[model samples]
Target: MTSLKNVQSKSSKSCYVIFCCCTFIFAPLLIGSIIYQSSGIKIPTILSSINATFSVENLIDSPTKIIATIPHIPLESFICDKINISRFPVSSTTQTNDSFDVYRKNVLEKYCDIVPVPRYNWSSPKSYTENDIAFVIFTAAAFFHTRTTAARDTWVSRITNYYFLSATPYPYLPITVVPGAGEDKLSNMKKLFYGLQIIYKQQMNLSPDKQQKWFYIAGCDTFILPHHLLKRLHGLDYRQPIRVGGHWGQHDCPGPNGTKFQAEFPSGGAGFFFSMKLLEILQPHLTNYVENVWPRNSEISDVALSCLSHQLGVPLTKQVGFWAHPPAFTLGENGRDKFHKEPEPNDFHYIKPDEMHALDEFYIYQHMDRLINDRNWSEFTQFMRRFVASHYELLRKKRRECTLPTIEAEVKLSNK
Candidate 1:
């Protein structure tokens, strides 16, 4: 009886040991699985901080890093091959009205009748070289002010409608006028193509040389030309294959504060060169932006591109100019109430027709026998001649210095 009781006790001990071993082996796995499930639950990434920390450089250089770091968001995409850019000069003050439209139409008719050949020794380039270029003009209401106001001597035209046409005239010239549309109509990103298509039709008129090197010029109050523009952004060799319009300055553009006033760049109105490219890209998406969806009121299309850049992870090659003090406007003092004329040691202050001395005026009259009706063209050509005559040596020297990248190299890099 004692032996049987001892054996029962041993059997009970064996069962207890087996249970202990099982608990030790399985406990870690159960706890580990609970911890693993908790870890699998994700916390969303904060974006505004990422935007502030990462810069335009990171976006340009290594976009993937930023893509991984930021939260995923839906982006509107359109296949765009061209970019529409517009230029507004800072001097003119003509508003859009019926009478002004008539005047502009007349200018266009006259411009189309003439050929924009190599007008000046320097105004026309020999060939649209390795870095080919084009211009897209945005005619705002102000450029319609054709008269020579004050001694500023802005907007003079010379119409020789009879004595032109050595070659087939570029059809959209004398003046290429863009019909005005309300900003509300333009704000839709999808429908921007209609305006682009219209521009493309006009550009078809340029000479093959001018066509290859197409550049758009607008009749607005705050335009920046391509020469100064390319210099300001990247070294002239940089591929400005893409750009878009946004806010710029305040003199002609009426706004409390805009990209124009910001001191540091990557802000400011899209200048003339950009308009050409914008037209090219937005045409495909124009129907979408303009027709279906409405444009955002505060967000100008040009400014919207910057936001788009962030969304797409595409880096802007250069930052637009921003203003801190009074803006750098082309129109002389009389054009603006806020304008101040400080001593500009760097500028070549050319003498206007009125500024000339009696002897100088007499000489000009003797030399200027050619008859041209448009004061804007006459004065501008005269200024160009004077500028060239005074600084031709300097300009020629600078031309030699303006080195551009080879097209083959650029193409190779782009492919990579």
Candidate 2:
């Protein structure tokens, strides 16, 4: 009887220990998630905070730090929220003469009508307009005449506050030189970080009337449709901390210390966005993060920022329609038309100079709604499929390109 009593006591003690361990290990995470999801307030994760602070012992213990750092952002704001192209929704009785214009004139020219601009009764007193969005475009000396020019001529004009940055500046062009940014493997990454810093500083100095509510960060190689982009932003709550993009996945950055740090980030080429509230949170941390964290960063600005954001508990909310590559390369992969069959895309990356012009003109002349008349669009669709086949290899990259193979995306944010 004594032996049986001892066994029962031991089993009960073991169970108690196991339960304690589990509660200790998981309770904070569960609580943190619940609070964050419910309130949209980012609670700086204790573990992530500790990891970053100690990542560089040199700074943590040193009294003379590189710069004064803002320890944390108050959990005041957090909010959250891409592209594909389709053909023929609106038609103009008078369409510009292009190769495709000939096709439209022969078939659906008479049916083409200008789409009426949408008017919204906004809940906020201030509605989002072209002035409300600022664009920060990454470019290089090599692309100044080609990609940059194409972008300027096409969509870059809508917003008054647009910046083109490069490591090597061409005074003749709109591109500005980033201090200490080099034209190396990590050039684009450097540009990304420095560009944000520029936006934060420049926007903060602007008068209230000129301040931007949203910021779009993209490469010069990307072709963006301002109309569609604004449409997407219109539905979002700009007052909250919002980070929206297409490319998102975990990436590993191996430091000189031989440790591999991982972060989930959006790809830079297709473009990403930040709400004004997010920019304010990030602005105070940029100097500290660049000084302390850049050394251990993935050397990709997007991934590096993702790591910093992870520490600060910022989430990358994903959206569809940010096409990774031009239609020619991606059209037939998931069965031709399967991708375009979806909603009209906002942007396309990995496009050539001519391709940018072609796409810009297409969207300008051809209407984007597939629901207009299936019969008319079907013929145009078949023609585009043949065009895709004939021009399969529009531009070839000497180095392997960093592109998301699919347009598939997801919202990885808290419930709010």
Candidate 3:
């Protein structure tokens, strides 16, 4: 009876030992397999070293480190891939005003990917006088009171000769605004034609030796670096009827069945340069040209001018440094309002009214001097690149924070 009792005790002990060994060996594998199946993440086979470096709690709290451990994965792609959001539907109702607003918002959101930042190679400041170039500035009567004022207070003073091209009277600049045919695209073209007429008349009135070599046209919002522009112009022959400006590649026209057209015109925002010879060639045909190419409401003045250049068989030279979009520094409200307002020894002083019009004007007022005087163009370029990168980073962070909610709301609205 004693021997049988001892055998039963030994058998029970052996069973207990087997159960302990199985739990110790198989529990971790089971847990890891469950995690892998659910989350599509492979659990590391060896955890002892990993645990020594990063605690499980720390890894849970900071998933960014875990994401970093993954190779060649962008944070945006990771987050966006993880979140399942429905796309906003496009229907016939998308043509409505409210839907158009949403469409425009969507388009603007994609600008970071579409539009490229402008870059220019720096040249040594050349010895060219103000008399070498004349400026024709385009503005509307609506914007004249504000945009025109901002322009005059800034870079306009740096040049000797500049004419305001508008239908309205601007006596503050003391130059009569040249009247266009009317305020429409065709009218704006006529205004430019009229401006050319005026410049031609002035040139005809002057002695041949005293005539200017280059004619420049810019919008009120454009910031001109006179020294840099003059340096660029100096390299080209004033004797030839050359057209110089930034060029855009093939882009779709603004219509439902928009066809792509190759545009080699300078961006009007960055401004364009016409040699005196080219202006002279254009003078004789200005009236007829304006009458024939009567601007369609959808036609852009710059593109039209480029087309005209092609028709005239003039060469279009692509130069850099012209910016179509405002710089990153002049993005926010504070940057637009009070940038470079602090008085400096050599700075141009102007009383910026309580009401301001364009941010580009303020940006020019702030950085014109620095850009003109940049002895180290490479350094300036690097600084600008860094500034733009930082701006985009912050913008990306903001977009990421709000993307989920915005997308969800849009999805709900679409469903309704």
Candidate 4:
């Protein structure tokens, strides 16, 4: 019985030794895993490498540094909330293209339901007239002739005053030379500033009676529907210092030391309107703002102007029709063919160009007159719904057929 007691004691001591060894081996690992999960960092590997030197403070601080270096997601509120449509439906069971098409169709239907229809009488001659608004188009010399000529032939006649503003000389067109600014993106910002200066100087020189009521700045590639634009502007009090455009937000600007700054600005593609009064107010401070206050190396003209607008207390009003992206109906083979038709001379064009090459005088006006004059609001909406769905499907198909293969080839080459 005494020998049995001795054996039991030895067995108990062996069990205690195993328990102590297991705790020593796993306690640190368990703690490290908890820390990793909480901090969203790989703490186990780090702890293993620096087990002797690791401390609680180091584990906590490392994640904070990583978080600081990451770029922030842009705020949705900075831009207009009109196009924040519901996400396209997707399911694990379905193919990506099919799911995207379904989503696109759904969104097109929603857009058609809400697009505003013109209430003014189309048959009445008094419904439309040339206004005192001026179009200050920022053009490059390369496409200046083609783009400006297209504008003149298409929509320029609907407005009273318009000029193609460019750095290079276009002796044929009534071009306003904004010297010292180049044709690059950074130069575009400078060009806008200088153009504003010129406009201000002209205003200063003009008799009070002859001063323009509003100034519209747009890219050379932009196609604007003068009648629709005028109708929209007529609703606003131009005498007040107000600005309006297709508002964009949630853009991140890089700052010093791996930081990002959020920005909200109007898209230059859709065009932006500034009341004469607003321009007058901005004119005095334009030089100082551009020279001193504007952020360096910022190439986007819209963003620069937006920053200045923020500082000057001019709020940007968002218009639904002001499209920043290329319109849905203007993509793929059908869209290209559609834009190649000639529009009627008398009717107001509702389509605007988002790119230089999109200006097709022959096709852009195709069925536009009917859409503008013959179709009722409901009919117009339905037409647009069909147009959007068809165009987007072609776009998706093209991307899948052309773009995906190119991307795959690039990936393979990189892998090699």
- Report the Cα lDDT for candidate 4: 0.55
lDDT (tens digit, per residue) of candidate 1 on 56-164? 2221222221121232221111111001211233235765533423433433222212211111122222333313544332332222222111111211111111110
What residue runs in model 2 are displaced by over 4 Å at the alpha carbon? 1-127, 253-262, 295-299, 336-338, 367-416
lDDT of 3 by residue, 261-356 (tens): 444666666678888888888877777656655335543566666666666788578765555544342224225333334211111112233212
Model 1 residue runs over 4 Å out of place are: 1-143, 146-193, 204-208, 212-219, 223-227, 233-240, 244-272, 275-279, 294-299, 305-314, 319-325, 328-416
Off by over 4 Å in 4: 1-129, 250-263, 329-416
Models sorted by TM-score, best on top: 2, 4, 3, 1
Number of backbone collisions per candidate: 62, 13, 0, 8
Worst 10 residues of 4 by lDDT: 71-80
Best-first order by lDDT: 2, 4, 3, 1
| Tens-digit lDDT string for candidate 4 (1-416) | 44777767665665565555556656766776566467542211111121221112222212211111221111121011223443444566856644534534433333222222222124322322345677888777776546665564445533457777778876555578888888776777777888888877887798887777778888765667664565546467667887877635646644446566665677776778888888877777777756766665776777777666665677787754565444444323224333333221212122333232233331233334334434456745754675566456545544543433333334444554
In candidate 4, how many Å is residue 120 off? 9.6
- Please report, as a residue range, the 10-residue window in candidate 2 with the lowest summed lDDT: 76-85
lDDT per residue (tens digit) for residues 1-416 in model 2: 44777767665665565565556545776676677668653433322211111111222222221222222212210110001111344345755544343544443232112111111111221357666888888887777767887776656643456888887766544566787767665676667777788767887798876788888888888988765666666567777888888756888753446667676777777787888888878777776666665763345676777776666677888876676677655564544455655345668889888767766655643332221212356645644664454233222221223354687688688886
After superposing candidate 3, which stretches have Cα over 4 Å from the reference? 1-124, 184-186, 250-263, 329-416
**Residue 33 deviation, candidate 4, in Å?**
80
> All candidates: CA RMSD in angstroms?
28.8, 25.4, 21.6, 23.9
What global local distance difference test value does model 2 have?
0.60
Model 4 vs. true fold: TM: 0.50
Estimate the overall C-alpha local distance difference test score of candidate 1: 0.31
Q: Candidates' lDDT values, in order?
A: 0.31, 0.60, 0.54, 0.55
lDDT of 2 at 144: 74
Winner on lDDT between 1 and 3 is: 3
Give each model a TM-score: 0.32, 0.56, 0.49, 0.50
